[model samples]
Target: MADIQRLSLNQATVQNWSVKEAVDGCVRHGIPSIALWRHKIHEAGLQQSAQHVRDAGLHVSSVCRGGMFVAPSAAERKERIMDNFRAVEEAKELNADSLVMVVGASTEVPIADARQMVADGLAELVPYAREQGVKIGLEPLHPMYAGDRSVLNTIDQSLAMAAPYAADEVGLILDVFHIWWDPTVFEQIQRAAGRIFGFHACDWLVPLPDTLLGRGVMGDGVIDNHALRLAVDAAGYNGPIEVEIFNQALWDTPGDDVLNKVVERFTALV
Candidate 1:
């Protein structure tokens, strides 16, 4: 059985629940940790969200998202960077383990230029995050999202992007949904070692219902979540194993029921 103590309820899995509700769900379901999204945090009021998690004694595994560096103009890029500065502040306020960064994709610029922009953005943001005592988790989206969501589309790419920074300052957030198909994923996971800040689990549906919102719960699809979990464990990431599904069907279900399913599938498959 997977360790129940290590399961973290990423708020995206229960999209309908408010921050306080998510925290309460964690308390009721015995989930020890949570990964929060910024919109939900803002909706619940940042201080209130922090206080709720604090009072419930739940660990904040990570704060969802603080990147999107690609832009057509310098002013727009600067705006995004400033927003990341605010994200760092938010992460510090919640005492989160890291600030998850879904680095932006190429806009009108060349793909190579977009990548350089991501590198430069990280160069600036990492120091600020470090100063705030927060870690930056560079999350590589699936390659399909490379044109719209993120330029960093593989574990190797994310690791390369993180190479210039100390492991604690910047690291990789490895998601099974995004990276399970890679031929060298296991080798990359081993290479990540001390540089993996978070581990996310979700299955990839065979038919792929929706590119962005079609992720399956741990066992509902083709990925060998257990093997991946073992690989991450072998890679020395002994922290929370977050369930971060993005399926509309799951979101439409009652939040408690979804949590129940998550616990069941995670225990059996992950």
Candidate 2:
């Protein structure tokens, strides 16, 4: 059996639940860790959110995000950088493992220009994040989301973006839902090795749901969870395997039930 201690329930899996409720549910379910979203933390107030999680004796595996460097103007890029600085501070306060990043897209500008913006933004942000004792996790969203959600759309691309910095300062987030389709995934996982900062698991549904909200639970879709887990383990990552799904049906279900299914599926597959 996979160690239950290595499984974390990402808050987005149960979006309606408050931070306190998610923490309580994790404690009740014998889940040792959680991945929090910034909006949820804001709703509870940062200090209160940190205290609540600490008081409950739960480990924060990671904080939702700290990216989006693609902006229209210099002034706007600075604003995004400042927001990322705050995210790093919040992660420090929460004692999180890392701050996840979805480097932004280029709808109007050239893709290369957008990528340059991300690189430039991280050049400044990584140093500050390092000073604050927070690691930056560069998550490459799927190509389907490349147009609007993220320009960083592959494990190798994220790794390349993080290459200029030390492994401790910048790393990659491997999500099955996003990278499973890549033929070079395992090879890239090997290359990532110690720089693998976070691991997220969610299967991709077939008939490919028209909406991005159609993620499937583990074992319910086409991903080879066992292979991916083995590859990540072989690449020297033993961190929490976070279950981050965006299914509307799962969100509508009772939070406890969603968590139960997550645990059950995670245990069976990963």
Q: Report the number of the highest-lDDT candidate.
A: 1
Model 2 lDDT tens row, 37-141: 999999999999999899988899999988999987999899999999999999999999999999888687688899899999999899899899999999999
Q: Lowest summed-lDDT stretch of 10 residues in model 1?
A: 103-112
> Alpha carbon lDDT of residue 24, candidate 2?
95
For each candidate, C-alpha RMSD in Å?
A: 0.7, 0.9
Off by over 4 Å in 2: none
Best-performing candidate as measured by TM-score: 1
lDDT per residue (tens digit) for residues 1-270 in model 1: 588899999999999999999999999999999999999999999999999999999999999999999998999999999999999999999999999999897659778999999999998898889899999999999999989889999888888999999988899999999999999999999999999999998899989999999999987889999999999999999999999999999999999999999998888888
Q: What is candidate 2's TM-score against the reference?
A: 0.98
Clashing pairs in 1: none
Prediction 1 global C-alpha lDDT: 0.94
| Backbone N/Cα/C clashes per model | 0, 0
**Candidate 2 C-alpha error for residue 9, in Å:** 0.8
